[model samples]
Target: MDYAGLDYRNIRFPVDRPLTESERAARYKQESYSNASPMDFLSVIKLNSNSIDLVDRWYPIKGFNTWFGICVVLVSMGALAGIYSALFFSNRTAPIETVDWIGVSALTPLFLLLTLGGWWLIRTECGRFTHYPMRLSRKTRQVHFFRQNGTVLTVPWDSLFLTLGESKSPLSGTTYDLRAHVLDDDDETVRDSFSLGYPSPLGNAESIDKFWAFLQPYMEAEDGVEKTWHHLKENTGYLVPVDNRREGWRWSIARSFMLGAHWPYLQLLFSPFLGLNALGRMLAMSTSKIPQWPADVERESQPEVNDPYVLTWRDNGSLGWWELYWPLICTVVGVGAFVGVIAWVVSGLWR
Candidate 1:
């Protein structure tokens, strides 16, 4: 059969193109010789790949470290204070030497108690998360990441106007490698998969250009998918042929730093850190929903031409603060409070 015999030119979209028969015939020809793998249509897509809301992980280290660190130090100091009180208050006449040793002994148990309790809380919070998949769903403009309870988180993709793939995170200094694949209704073949480097410091520009690298073979295979993919990317403007090294809004950093990063939906709080995250989401929503303000990429940038396919990807690993983390935070705080109370009581007894 000739490359033009498939006659698949009926499809059209909001964009300005369609799949002609020649394209289908060529695709068929390649299929005849290709050893394509089974498609992995994700039952769920990772919602917030680039953002904190989409991926599940231990709380970002900075906040957790600082907060938890303070708790630990505070409790330790309390233990020491409590011991001192125990020693001096027992009889007010005990030798100073005896007093010192007794006081130190009192702290030993307190230290052990707080240490174990804090450890348990942190561990418990970090383990309960099992499913944390996210997807930008260019088609739906929705961000979906699963929660610890298996309830899916659905947020509008417009909530993040900037999501360029980055190999490096300013906070963790951890580099990320991202990949995407198109799934058939049955997920038979990864019709297309590649990377798009965003314009950022922690990003790899060379990697951004690589999207089309993996995509070209598929691009030549079908016209609609290429056009649709490009159109979507363009409209989102979060994506680019390569990462743009733009100094993203400073608010992005402040937001990323606070609330230990988002966990799906967040109710507002007075905390500026929390507010920062809200602001980031608001900015994203604004960019995506406001029609008057142009999308970073225009509809013209991504057009419809050949085949249209849905793609999904995973960070392929676990990460920061979440529902599981809350309990951990609470446990540490509880221990600190407990020790503070003990110290206060002992100080009074000694006096």
Candidate 2:
């Protein structure tokens, strides 16, 4: 497929295009404050027939990184200090109360656990932050990690293991992590590692998977290992092309929910509320074609026009007001309810 016109793939970093004042400002804002979108982080740079570059320029926004670690440390410290002051310094004349001891006893272990966990997280983030612009070169079959001190560590492709790491949260379902680890001489000890930072729960599995699909073609593996890996990759549903126009918002929601449900069945219970948000997104897309791929690539990847299921919304004609308005109302209500529940839970926690 010809990707000559693709905004991401075609552009070189330190992008050559001249920027207007506003564009420059926007660029600076993105660099300083905003996280790089999945597209920007994983966008494949085809250097030549044998070489491709996958660079990691941003940290995963949603994880136990430096910011989260700092919050944990600050909160735990304040709570512990408050407890200590109330117990030891509030009234010097009063005998040490049993209740005070109980409070201290109860909170001490939890506080220690949180503090230690947060410290570990801080160290991990420090390592990641000090290493930026991690470059993986397919041609050299080597992954190059660029450190802050003008040093680079290169590990061959065979010395690395690519695996998916996942974590589950009550509020956000399950999040997937794409990580690469470098093995030591024993081939068992992990010498170094880094996450590629897609964080799939935020409707980004498709994008992450697409990036993985691109890498799989270049990755070298033994015959048996390659076959097993390919089978697993195909089952991941990342290779499936989503036709948003034909599938509509409903289909998108169903697909996302199914992905969630595949790992955790609890997500199935919330499908109704989730479907509402999905419907709203689909309604917005109804007004225009939501192209998931570049023109040439889309043309090449999509099935033949004669396929029975390829009819788009345009081909099927517009929905009547009766068909759209009811769903819109339900979606608004679902969003409101979801927000209210969150606010109530947060308020209770604050109190």
Candidates' C-alpha lDDT = 0.33, 0.43
TM-score each candidate: 0.26, 0.37
Each model's number of backbone clashes? 40, 0
Q: Cα miss at 48, model 1 (Å)? A: 19
Per residue, candidate 2 scores C-alpha lDDT tens digits across 251-309 of: 33443344344333344345345444354334333433322322432233343444332
Candidate 1 residues lying further than 4 Å off, grouped into runs, are: 1-110, 113-127, 148-151, 163-351
Highest lDDT: which candidate?
2
RMSD after CA superposition, every candidate = 19.9, 17.0
Tens-digit per-residue lDDT, 215-247, candidate 1: 223323344345434433443222211011211
The lDDT, on a scale of 0 to 1, for candidate 1 is 0.33
